[model samples]
Target: MIDRDALQGHLQQLLEADRFKDYGPNGLQVEGKREIHKVVTGVTASLALIDAAIAAGADAIVVHHGLFWRGQDGRVTGWMKQRLAQLIRHDINLFAYHLPLDAHATLGNNAQWGQQLGLVADARFGDQDLGFIGPVPDGLDLPRLSELVKRKLGRAPVVVPGDGRPLKRAAWCSGGAQGYFEGAIAAGVDVFLTGEISEPQAHYARETGVAFLACGHHASERYGVQAVGRHLEVNLGLQHAFLDIDNPA
Candidate 1:
């Protein structure tokens, strides 16, 4: 067992939360017991995740996404009230790392998702600091790579080709980040990929002539936090299990 405060401190340091520019706070959100043994890790700490943690008799739940969104007030009411009620009733600590998980060179969503897609991982890039691009080699056609994406993510992507050419390079940022397509274009990647696509984003992809793929917002992001949890269990000697809360979006 490990002290909750100490564990959060360790994770914050390991993630180097301050190193990357992000949108939300990255660290411990709700304090609970002094020590924790069983931890449930997931992509997002929604109601389903919290319930799974409680059912599994976990001491804490750690996630890539958590409560307290950027502009959201701290007031817990309505849905937030019910969410926090579950945690408080069960005395389960919640640790969240938003941008830190997204930007980490190894365990971040970008790297994990890239690894899943059979892309050779590299350092993160661009203003958003979401993730890095992959060189798909000179000869691989877009269709084959799309199949690979489907194989990895378990969902055929909504693909739109920008240019009438075979793919040479591609970039990925898991989750609702169609905003980065222009950067992918600027980086000269033949394709740009994200989780969910916006209507405007689809138009931009068609207009800019960049091959765009939306694998899934939730599906593309399940690996990194699980990686972190496994690392913690193996390295720190804690009992950690990942609880997947099915989110279609």
Candidate 2:
């Protein structure tokens, strides 16, 4: 077992959580037990994840996404109340890292995704360095790259081909970052990839000739939380398990 305060401190330092302007609070959204034995890490802090963690006898749940977004109503009623009540009743400490988790140099979602795709990250630009730009190795085209993405992420990407050219450079941001496409285009990358796609992005891809790939948000972001969990296991001597709650968005 580990002290909750110590763990939270280490996580804050490890992630530099205070450096980013996030949509919600970054740590300890729900207070639970003082001692944490086993930790359950997942993409989002859904009720199902909480129940699963409780079933696994975990004292804490760590996640990338958590309750209480910026625009959400402050009232604790209905579904929010139920979710919070469950956590309070079970005494599961809820720790969430938002933009910090996505921008970490080594353990961030974009970095992990880049590593998996064999892209050597050369630079990070766009919002708070959330967007990653890197080289695509020789002989990789849109179709071949899409296949590789499918093989690695276990989900076929929503692909929009551009310019009918060999892809040389690419940029990406994991988890619903289609808004960064313009920045990637401005960076002169051959392709821009993100987790989700909007209606307007399709037109941009065609007009700007920058290939766009909508990799599954959940699939793309699975690595960061797991990476943090593994770090806790190896460095902090804590038991960790990753629970992947399937999200099709």
Q: Highest TM-score among the candidates is held by which one?
A: 2
Pick out the ten consecutive residues of candidate 1 with the lowest summed lDDT.
120-129
Candidate 2 lDDT by residue in tens digits, 87-107: 999999999998988989899
lDDT of each: 0.83, 0.91
Model 2 residue 180 distance off true place after TM-score fit, in angstroms: 0.1
Instruction: Report the lDDT tens digits of candidate 1 across residue range 87-168.
Output: 8888889998987887788888888888876676444556656758877755567888788888887888999977667677
| Clash totals for all candidate models | 2, 0
TM-score of each: 0.94, 0.98
